[model samples]
Target: MLSDRRLFLLTLGSASLASLAACASGPQRVERPMNGDFPGIPFADWTDQEPEYLLYPGDEIEVATPTASELTRTVRIGPDGRIALPLIGSVMAADRTLPQLQQVVSAAYAPQLVRPTVEVTLRQAGPIRVWVDGEVRTPGVFEMIGDLDAYQAVIQAGGFAPTSRQDSVALIRRGPGGSRMMRVVDLRPRRGEVVPLRRGDIIFVPRSTLGELAAFFTQVRAALPIGFSYSINGSNGSGFAQF
Candidate 1:
């Protein structure tokens, strides 16, 4: 089985494609459509006027919960996409939207609760980390926040170096069809290109595209022992050596 750190690094190593796509796709801006009483986030932050927040696989939501007589009492769904409600058992709550989930839950309780004023709230926001690796001056991790663009990620990594890969700055992201890796608008400084990056993304700045895969592996190997040593020593400095 793969270790957690390896899994995390692998996820980071692979997602550079999304970063590339974001740059290549270019930044798009537009207005958000209205959905009944629900509010809409402006499109000024999206690419091609896409949804403000790209929904992912394991997003968490919690309802403020209605009164005992108002709902099926207290039915909540776990992060694993399973829910053991007052009546309904585990049901897939994967891609369904908030409104869609509310409707589904309420519908099930129609025979019990009245009208069911449902409210969907994000209980545990999914992982929204951005990873920056290779050649960059300060390659590491970044938190994905409001309107984070690809340019922003590179900048956060303490900017590129003189011997920087420049053109091969790869940004990887995940979507419906597994994952797509592409070369985005060339990272020529001051080109006014580069798209906004997303959560669970990995941006790689290599010396050149020709040997980046090898470079990444080399970097990982060198990093592993140090990282492991640091963690072990950190948990218990002198005690670690005693074991």
Candidate 2:
């Protein structure tokens, strides 16, 4: 007995409800090749080529001058990535290997003392930290007690949220020459792949599969909670962004 227009409206409402129900049940898994031009390496193909020990801001080191014992002192690398010495003043210390720093210090003090030999030893290393964000129950920075992979770090952040796209998580890291490097990692169960995390690595779990790396950065900046700052520059064509 219903009118034709009323019948059509009823059918449309029923279809919308059905669609919502399907979405509530679970996400449909789609298997597709990642974008070839995406500016990130595949997690499976990534290799860790970091130096043995790169100095950080909080690292404490012993600068010993055997030739001039009085000049020997222990100092911590300041937040500005420099250490203040007796005669040479502030010298850049962070990112330099022990031997490289030793040579720099020796050269700096060459004019002040004869045979200005300097031995730099790491007295204490700084805390290792990583940032885990997006679609995780608890998103924040965490200290790495030991070796942890991308998956394990997410677990520490209270695991992935229900809407997380576990099949395609983004891992951003600092590459050579301070450039940004990103990798797509699969954290689905039984995948049996391990993407080892390095200090300052960022594990971002997208709510859905990302089509473009540049777009992903914009989404990250928006989703990040207060007290966190992230920015991207898409205009310059450099594709470099700060996180």
Candidate 3:
């Protein structure tokens, strides 16, 4: 009978062998759709046209009430995505368009005033961040605004590197259902490419075809075994050999 330690090792080795057998067919790459526009982004009305900039953390805005000038003051959205107002206390501002925030402010003050005329204007835009990784000059998180598009974001990251596959850049976005969706966007220069990037998006520029082949060879080299052997000897030390 094998010692407890040897038995445990034997069980682990058996499981690993089974897993390897199941994967004998090798990795099957999923063929994703490649297109000019990014999926999940609303782009029908997208142009060089400016988006209805949503309020986010670090944004500065002035809320003006025609009747109540005292309530009209410039305030910065806190990191918590909320703003403190004298009457309304703390109001959630993140992810809300200017008009939507105006409505929220007005409703909050409805009990105080018969009709509160609330006008919200962006005093100054603030730092908005997105992750730009893979095959760019600088692959990291970057700060940008609402109008920033995928092209511009890549440029800000020091543009594409020589190893980049410009035709198939992946834009990973988190859907409202809390699931992530990936869309391979064609970044070839063209006239009036109007796709816009959003906050917290990940822009991954895949490696060129040549680089992909090199990666596959590296994987093969790492996985290929030159020699191996394992056996159990009766009463003698456990038999295991490798070369």
Candidate 4:
């Protein structure tokens, strides 16, 4: 009998092969109408304000206390998204902006010190990485360099496999408040469109066109290996789902 892991892999492989075989029957089609515009993100949501940099694990940050020089120290954020300090102990630091973290550390040390002034500075940033899987020649986590879009990241993973459903690719990103947001992007050639990707983003190329965004999420979660957890919270009218 195949081990559980082996059995799961075999099942996933069969599903992928079936999807590819379906694609071979005809040209891939977009199941949902795009209405001549990209779905998910809205134009009004675009803003000129630059997004604040959030701290991540493996990032080295210098926490300075001018009043209490002895308590000042530089520490790298741990995998648990925390940093240990003299008086405050372990403080959650990941996913917080520099100013936000400074406030948090200062508040934690307030009772111990007369007037606590904490300054958090990014000494070194952690490696920016993204996950590319499904129908890609090489599917794995890759360190991102400079600006990259979903299509560019796929190219970094040795482009799409022959059986990849190029017209429908899934981009999963971390949404506000730790929610997972998924968007289906069209990566066909000459589309003159790009879906910008951020650190820790997941780019999944499916073997067949994704019909309904909700159902596709379910299929993807099951088809992927263990550890890829997904839950659909709800969907926006424009093919976006929060998981």
Give the TM-score comparing model 3 with the true structure, all chains together. 0.51
Backbone clashes, candidate 2:
0
User: lDDT per prediction?
Assistant: 0.50, 0.66, 0.61, 0.66
Kindly list the per-residue Cα lDDT of model 4 for residues 15-49, writing each as its tens digit: 34445555668665444222123333221222223
Residues 148-236, model 2: lDDT tens digits: 98889999999999878677676666555344444556798777358888887777676643233344444445444423212222355
RMSD of 3: 18.4
Better of 2 and 3 by TM-score: 2
Q: Which lDDT tens digits does candidate 3 get at residues 114-201?
A: 7798999998877667777667998766777548888888899899898776655656554442233445566766732445887656
Off by over 4 Å in 1: 1-49, 52-61, 64-96, 103-118, 122-129, 144-147, 161-163, 174-183, 192-194, 199-201, 215-243
Candidate that beats the other on lDDT, 3 or 4, i.e. the better one: 4
* TM-score against native, each model: 0.46, 0.64, 0.51, 0.64
On residues 33-98, what C-alpha lDDT tens digit does candidate 1 reach at each position?
A: 122211221111113332324333345556434655333333334333445555555555544567
Query: What is the total number of backbone clashes in candidate 3?
Result: 0
Residue 135, candidate 4: Cα error in Å is 1.8
